[model samples]
Target: MLSLNSSAMYTGASALSALAAALLGTGTFWPIGLLYEAANVLVAIIAAAAIRERGAAGH
Candidate 1:
C-alpha cells in the first residue's frame, strides 16, 4: 500500500516535474509559471471571498 506521506508526495512531484521539463523544455516552463501564479491568485481570491461570506453569516 502506498502511504500519503511527505516524502512520497515530494518524490512524485519531483518525478512529474522532471518529466515535464524533459518534454516541454526549460524556456517554455518560465512563461507557463505566470499562468500558474495567476491561477493561484484566482483561487486565493475566491477562497478569501468565501471565508469572508461565511464569517459574515456567523458560522
Candidate 2:
C-alpha cells in the first residue's frame, strides 16, 4: 500500500514537471510549481527506496 502511494506520487510529480516545462516554454511563471513537484517526486522516490531497503534487510 505504501509503495502504491509512492508510485502515485512519483507519477504525479512527473506530470507536474512536464506541465511546468511546457508552461515555462510558453514564457510563464511555472518555476514554483516545477520546484514543488520535483521535490515531491524526489521525496517519494527516496521514501520508496528506503522502504524497499528495509524490507529487504528484514527489519
Report the number of the highest-TM-score candidate: 1
- Flag regions of model 2 displaced more than 4 Å: 1-29
* lDDT minimum window of 10 residues, candidate 2: 26-35
- Scanning candidate 1 in windows of ten residues, the lowest lDDT window is 27-36
Report model 2's TM-score to 2 decimal places: 0.50
Error of 2 at 27 (Å): 12
Q: Per-residue lDDT for 1-59 in model 2, tens only?
A: 99999999899879977877777887767676777777779889999999999999995
Per-residue lDDT for 1-59 in model 1, tens only? 35667777789668756766664766467655765576579879989999999999995
Model 1 quality (TM-score) = 0.51
Candidate 2 clashing pairs, residues 3+ apart or interchain = none
